[model samples]
Target: MTTPAKPTKNFRFVTGNDPDFFKDKKIVSANRSFVMFQQAKKPCDGIDPLKPQPQRVEKASKRCDASRPQPRTASIPAGAVTETPCPPGMSSDDALGLFRGDRRARKRLVDRPQPNQRVLNQILSLKAEDLPFATPNATDMCSFYALLQTEAAQGVLASRGKLTDGQLLFEAAYEGFMSTFPLRVVGSPHDTFEVLPKFKGDFKSSMEELKCHCSATFSCPNLGRTWIPKATSSKLSFLSTLCISAAHLDAMRGERSIWAPLMGQMIPLLRIMTADRTLNTSDQAIISVLQVLLGTMIACQEVSSNIHWQGLAQLVTLRGGLLQLDPVIAMMISIHSVESSILSESPIVPEYLEFLRQRRERSQPGQPIRYSPLYSNQVELMELRHDPYCSHNTYELLCDIYSLTNLISIMRSPIAELKNFQSLDDMEAERQSICARIACLPSAFSGDSKDLSRRARIVRYRFESCRIAALIYSNAILNGCSFSYAASQITPAFASSVKKDPAPRQNGRNTRSDSLPSIYRNRPVTITSYLKQLLARSDTSGLWGPLSGVLLFVALIGGTAARENLPVPTSATDLGTDSYNVKDRSWMAAVAVRCGVQLGFEYQGTMEKTLVALADVTRMSERCDSAVVEGWRASQEPEILEKSLHDGNGSLGNTSAPQTRFTEATTNEIHIERVSEGWPSTTGQADPSSIDWGFLNGI
Candidate 1:
């Protein structure tokens, strides 16, 4: 037996006991064994035995080891709109027509063999890297590499879960945060604004020297200028890459509104890019900040911001101040600042309107900022400047009005910029600067209401009404002044006073002995009553006719101020914000409803978004539980989550928008539902606990 075993050992085995042998190899040397039934420790919905069960748990590093996000697809590059129009029977791809001239060719067309549009696109889209600006410097390369690292890390994140409910995240037990998209936007070798702007200056110039910086992000084109935002090309800078990606994701969020996952990935990258103190004021850095801000506005179609506007504003200030900023962008920032002030009902740092005033002075050296006497508060309304091609006057006036409301807001609420104040004087200086801003308003239309056209008069009345409301609100905040006092304060006597004297006061001192004007000497009237009477005397006769834009601003300020000091409704039954009774109809609610509806905004999200916009633009804000607050007459049933299987019943009638009917109500007691445009009114009170904060201004 020992001799036979020794002989066997001398011969090598053909297969596995030598590795693949008894290891369940296929056929005679099969490696794996087949089981009749695949079993889990417990029952599950999973169709695959290898896959983790839905109920309890699964190992992620094993089962959920999804591939990293894919590399970005080649984006369709866009060039200047000057290309030859697409030929007949062809699509936009043929927009640049083929060389259909004589086959003999005068000088031989480019791409002679096959008229390729991409050749033209390549030439047009190529960034001249040889140029000084395009050439990579140390900082740009560093930023590019850091961004690259961030992208690589972001790609490693597993995205293998479903978010069944409305709320934003998906859960993979092993990984903290998971996304649904298999692939996300990643930086590519070639990426930039799909639709390039016709550069007005040196196209190769760096951002700081570049003359044409459209407010639109490099990820997209100017809103209505093109049907949709085009894909990014290779022209964009690394500093703005994160912002553009974030914005592009926002823009392409067609049917799905899941921004949480996208924002989660991008925000960290943005923070990383902006974290370094050295890059805070860098040109590309500022561009990144502004792109995020502008991108947010473009996506939501709302001027109000829920992002880092303070950091953005700081970057703008550090760079060169908003005055040196692009005109369109500067104005938008100024408006946003003013609205934000109103929303938070507090002061923003370094008042944005100061930049506007400086811009005005730079544009017109001799003409000083002039104040409108129609405003009880000082505001720089444009009266002297006129341009047939542009409506700078209206815009300037609106800006001033926003600034004034902002001032009033500051007086009422806690200032957010206080932490940034270098000294206590900075606060007082802010107040003084606000006063100066008001004094700078153009007053050409303030003095002579009689000289104004009917159209002009209507406009003046509407806006001036806002001025009065702001004054009243400020007065209330300061001295708890009554509506009558508010009415008396709005005296348009400055022009008359100047005309009567024909002499500049010795030291430009106000010499008036009586605070109350002559007309109000013996009369007792409220602002709301006075405004109604004045409107009655006007050509339009009421707050009716063409309405949109700044009218919402007026409604919030004027309506809130005009509302007689009724005790704010504490109970669900008490709803009227204004009296709609005949003979004493304040019409404040009516004006609010009319202005809100005239906005033509869809019923959904109107309340939240508009409320937010009004607060920003006008500084007038009111509290309402938008989520629970039903429309004119909506009803809802609580969703029964426990019961997943239903007998398949149709949903209840659409109580999404409420209904209303005219009825005689003798008392001031009325439904808040009556004048709601965005918020539908319900018969019962809304739950105060549920509120949507999307549109709320800072306050």
Candidate 2:
């Protein structure tokens, strides 16, 4: 049927080649298709192409799913920043204030403050009866050492798992020990002497363990997860290093490993804080505490390095100036500056003076704070006494000492860079002013004997010794020997030569031996007698007083004076014509040396070396004196005289006889011998037991 319908020519498909297709076709075309459709059409398709079909529409569903709620995001305004608000119970402003030293917000977080909850918790963990003995006390010499060891062990174990917990525990233990320990009992013979060395060992060992735990926790790979940040770790290391070095300061003598590492860490952090010039009370408190601790070390000569001094001083200025420093630290720094100036013969006083002036200027206008009100009973118990003459306390006395010593220091400088004293006349006026101030101080021995405690006695001794040293050194400077050179040259070996002539007496002042310009030079016997008295009293006082540092300097001065050719005192207050021999003076110097050794400055080897050299020189002088007498007798011999007269020869018969210049020749020989022989080892060679340090050990 389909084939039958296709027989029609109009219905059949035809190609362009069909004769009828071209004959019937017109050139006209249907209306143009859409340009979009035409342009998108395939090349295979002719000019016309099919249009795109519309997408199919789907009906909306009425069912709802109620399990999940859509998120409600408020539209952010253009150019507006979005931030999360602070949670309830915390003020955003207060939280922000913390960086500026606002403590109110943080104080609220601490539930308890009075009893130091952390310290209380630690104390509760230990046996209650052992609490009194945890620190060194009158009753227990080596108290709390066993407890400290236990704490250290537990800390090490906990540090491996929870580092912050271990650190807190160790800090608690150290604080406990520091709070309880009475440092006065350390060198007191009334307590036990044998216990000190043991206690020191235990203390050092505990500090070492703490340091190890800190290092381990910090170096661990997962430190990021731990509670202690890098900054906290560094703080702990600094504290640990400080404690260890302080405990062993007598022997450490500025060991770089003991101090440098911790200082290195602290300096950078301090620099950052100082550079920003931000007011942070916490940082100020930290620096103040550090100053006290480090100043203590300096006072004890435990640290001789000035590496951090200038930097620390600048930091202190930025914090709140010198007045902001803790009272104990201030006192110690003053003492340290004086001692350093004297020893080095340089004036650190000018810079220190500027610091003080700035502090005074910054202080509020009120009655000047003579002593810091924030006193620590545990730390400054020994310095707590009041001196009525100064109207305040020992602090004023320290200020007085600093003032006088500062002037002396300036005077001693070759250039004398002081504005008040530019010439020798100006120096003399300033010197008189200082001498008057010293004279105004009541005699150290004037106090009633019955009222003196062990600490009082030490204070008295220290004051007297410092006063003596000032007088001696000042006079030496006036005599044309620079104070800087005098300190070193005043050693017993050189004193005799340095003072070939008698020191000039102060103008119109002879009320007492102490008032004399050159007390050591003019009245050796008087000074030695008083020093001997001090030594004898210390021997019986049941306290080991070696005159540490400043005190030792005083003793050395006395010893040096004892070697000079000066007459002994005929009466208690009067100098006499009768003089002690060289051998006797040497013995006197030996006494001073022995006293110095008792105080533990023996490691310095200064006093010991000076005494030994002085003794050798004394013996040489005695030998020369004997040879002189023999030569005089030989000259009187008739046969030798006649032979010399007849021969007209200037040469003597004997070549071995000493001449009048024997003393000078022997002095040169003595120095040469010392160099060649390498000088006898002073510190290590001597056996502590054999040297009769029994006085130090005795009760």
Candidate 3:
């Protein structure tokens, strides 16, 4: 028998039944089977199993007979094997298909007539070699930007009702801008305000140049004014829109790295762009930009600290600030600045007043009332917008309260320097003016002829609370103690001085009694009255929201009253205090805490600190009261008197002229429930002897 097999040089196949048949028979059988298997694997006329595979087979090389390694075959071509130029006038869909990896689609795209024939040809002709420095010229880039703007706007509008995959559109637009206007802003992946580096060309000139590159013919006539180069406005408007949209997505999904930096970069640019001389500051375009900036700042909690808030201050100071700014935004900036100033203890009272003045100057006779972003964004909250007639009055009321707070800050500084006497006369005059102004404003709490809104009620409560707080400040200032000075005076030496009378000086004047402010001097009734009003307003519901904003101010007033050695108000008319007769100002301090809790804000990270601080102040106030009472008692007790008589009680005998003892109290635990329900019970006896006067200023 013969095996019809090709033989390798390493071995040979032998026919059957020859000499050496045993060894050769085994080898010959194996060789014949292997040869048949190899033939089976190869393409055949019709019988090969693997022959129909599309992958080209490699020819095995003769190296060392069956043991040589095989090399990998290419799956697809890495580069164009042949040039296939797209015909001019191809449709964009077919042209875009090339990017989608449909090689046949490139040919199909050439079947249509393209309007941008030249641009289409240039794009199709691009090779790996031409990409390094390749760029579209000015006109082409501008056209391209227009195309991108349309696409981005369509995407934005499509997703307006809900945020869904919305970030992709903005992200693409932002990426395009960054690539096209490379020098406009420079920063790492994360920066709050990215702008051109200082080493670059003049920032203004560079920005103008960048804006000019994208300048097109489109205009938003509705935005008012044609001064802003159409392209410049469009580019900025698109960026701002993209940024805010992305921020909305981020706000919902919390993709922190995505939107935070986008806003951080965009807000500063918007500020700089609005400040650009090329754009009319009062143009509707710039106004829209500012509104978005302010709105984003208001909406995003993370943005609160990163933005250049002072830029808003500068804008408000400009002639265009008020003219261009919406009254709602201006009011927000004013309120926010004042709140921040009070917190930092570095007052920006002048800026706030300036914003208020601008808002008034721009106020029109019959314009619709404006609402804050929170109200505007929520349908439920929209009802909080006050009537047009009452809107101006509402803000005016707020302005008066802010002015009083400014005065209080000014008084504190002078009092701190002990030069308060120089300003006292001026402050007192201003105080009376402010009071008369506050009184002239329609009551926030009462009698509505045309309208009464929840916001109006909130405003009324705010006005009343601020009015009472201002009174407390003035009361402290009049009695030879500014709030700061009074806060600093909670010491052992000061506590000891509480019981002493003014000795007759050689000048024939009483040292202690003469310098006291008349409002707080020789009368516990006035201090008690102010404390009662402050506590009443503190517990009032309408003011519950802004209470947190003005917490420190309220705490200061409460602190002053609590440490004044005056009894808590016994008036049954005070909101929740009808059941308890208070003896110290601790209840007043507790009022701030309870109001914060009732508003469901006590658990906030920010308010938690305020609560701790309030508690500390309350505890300190109680300790101080105990010290004053104990010191007074030691002076009044008969046993001590007999001992002092025997010991010739030096100054203690001279000061025991009068003492009014209410029930004693000690450091009582503050109760939010009792505080919310009513004033805390005054059942426990207090000992003033344990008071630590040294740390009062520390609190």
Across 1-699, the per-residue lDDT of candidate 1 in tens digits comes to 353122221121222124433332122211101111123333478553453232222122223224644344321111211132322343322222222221332453652232233322322333312111122223211221222234332332222122122111111100111222111113522222221122223222222221122222221223223211211211222323333333333332221132323334435545755666665655555545554553443233222344468678677767678757655445445544543343233444345645433432122355222222222132233432342211444445555544545555454456645545464445444543443333223322334345455556555544444444444443332222333222233332111122222234458553431311211211223444444433332222222322233344443444344433333222212222233211122233233333332221222122223344344333222221121122211222234311322545433332332222222223422222223254333232222111111101110
- lDDT tens readout by residue for model 2, 64-175: 1124353444423211211322124434444344434656623545433233334434454643123221232232222233333455435644544433433333333333
Ranking according to lDDT, highest score first: 3, 2, 1
Off by over 4 Å in 2: 1-165, 168-282, 285-305, 316-345, 349-351, 355-471, 480-484, 491-699
Total backbone collisions for each predicted model: 33, 1, 11
TM-score for each candidate, following the candidate numbering: 0.28, 0.28, 0.28
RMSD (Å) per prediction: 31.9, 31.1, 25.6
lDDT by residue for model 3 (1-699), tens:
986433333332233334454343224334443444344565577774643222222122222223735355332221121122322454544444544566571334543322243443343343322212122254433343333334443454354334223232223223332134421222324221223221112222222332332232111232223222321334454445333334333322223333445555555556556556554343334434543543243232323533445555555556455545654345444544433332222334554545443332233466332222111223422333443222444344445545554565555454536765656767756754564344223223333323545444444444544544544443233222324223322222222222234355458544443422211112222333334433343334333333343444454354344333322223311212311213223334333323332222112323323323322233333323333334444534658656766887533323321112222133521111111122222232212331222111211
